[model samples]
Target: MPTSAAHVPEPGEGDGPEPWPQGISRRATMRISDVLRALRTEFPHVSHSKLRFLEEQGLIETVRTPAGYRQYSPADVERLRYVLVEQRDHYLPLKVIKDRLAALDTGTETEAPVPRLATADGDAGAASARRRYTVEALAAAGGVDRSLVDGLVEAGVLRPTTGGQLDAHALDVVVLAAGLAEHGIEPRHLRTLRTAADRHVSLVQQVVAPWRSQQTASARAHADTLATEIGELCARLHTVFVRQGVDDLTR
Candidate 1:
């Protein structure tokens, strides 16, 4: 009679802590979708385009299979997570983030707290969420005359809420319009931006519509996450395009 064989657990199976589950530990590399699934729990808004953008920015490294499929190791996922967390929590720009990453790679700095930029009043980011303004307050905050605010309202650039109040973002729009006005770009000329913003919003809604239609709490939450993520991504892309166009003019 042959002896009975003892049971053996496969890699990432049974007992020990599995940071990389679902047989990912056994695999040499994870596909983009696999990486997305692993990250979605913590970053519901992380998208394929975001990963590609990070790669293009030289922030993340990946291997390409013979067939051109991108392969990510566990380390790559960790590094990408670090980058995203720094951006989300610390509000650090990519240049600073990249510099920190470089320091880590060169063994110049260990994992430690970095100095953060702060406004005199406190965390402006947190404060801005609770800050609302009347039209007069908005004009004062923007350092613009009430006439500019009136012109912006007439041009449909600065729309107040139903409660007749403006949010922090309205102040930013007012200030930007005022600056543009100095350069002969009037608030009326900024109407195109409002129109473009609406179209971008419509695009985000269309992309998340199926998820939102599911009517489940999880699906609705996911849709909300996607909307926020895609909106920010669109804004970043627009900034990059504008910068590139400006660079071309200088060239």
Candidate 2:
């Protein structure tokens, strides 16, 4: 089955009623059942036949071992999370999710909307003066070390452009990471945050993906409303989870 949920073992996954398998570390390969348990939270309707159907439908692929048991990688889990989240949240047919995934596989971020969990205070779509930063400028502004910046890239925490320049979002996240570092958390520890953020985007995609269809204007407006509303809901859930953790700790 699937491996672990929350991508990398959240604050207290193991204490749950349906804890994932013991002795199966995050770095270890996992079976299909493992994948299902990991996914059941976000996609409660998931089932064995459904996963097999996805395989049959060619939405997701898995490698088999000597006995032909499915083995999945972290990347595979991330892809499955994307597919399931999209299908459940958007009521998207597998065909559309598969195409969007294929587009992502081809380094097509230009076509993919930047996935943000919270709508910002200002009009994010409104025009503003463009800005770019050299690594040094980014390091100074983000209040991170030059070596830490390179480490962020190595840890898959940052994505530089084709010309190797940092984007505004890059600075924003790095600066946020620096703020977290005040409590001694490292950038490396934040990879799970990025993965969870992608899953949130998958939720928005469910509402927004259909709008791109040559559908009616009314349908497009519905997509816009759902995206913003659902995105806010997801962000609220994240806050609630953090509050729960704090409650558990301080008591």
Query: Model 2 segments beyond 4 Å from truth?
Result: 1-129, 215-222
> Where does the lowest 10-residue lDDT sum fall in candidate 2?
120-129
Query: How large is the C-alpha RMSD of every model relative to the true structure?
Result: 12.6, 22.0
Please give the CA lDDT of all the candidate structures. 0.71, 0.63
Per residue, candidate 1 scores C-alpha lDDT tens digits across 11-86 of: 5567744332223233336789977876665565677867866776677656676677777766567677777777
Q: What is the TM-score of each candidate against the true structure?
A: 0.54, 0.44
- Candidate that scores best on TM-score: 1
Instruction: Summarize candidate 2's per-residue lDDT along 1-251 as a digit string, tens digits.
Output: 33223245432354542112222233326677777666654444556666665666676556666666766645455666666557544656557777887777555534643332212232322211135677778898777798777767777788788888877678777877778878988878888888888899898897688774735644554455456567767878998998999999999
**Candidate 2 TM-score versus the reference:** 0.44
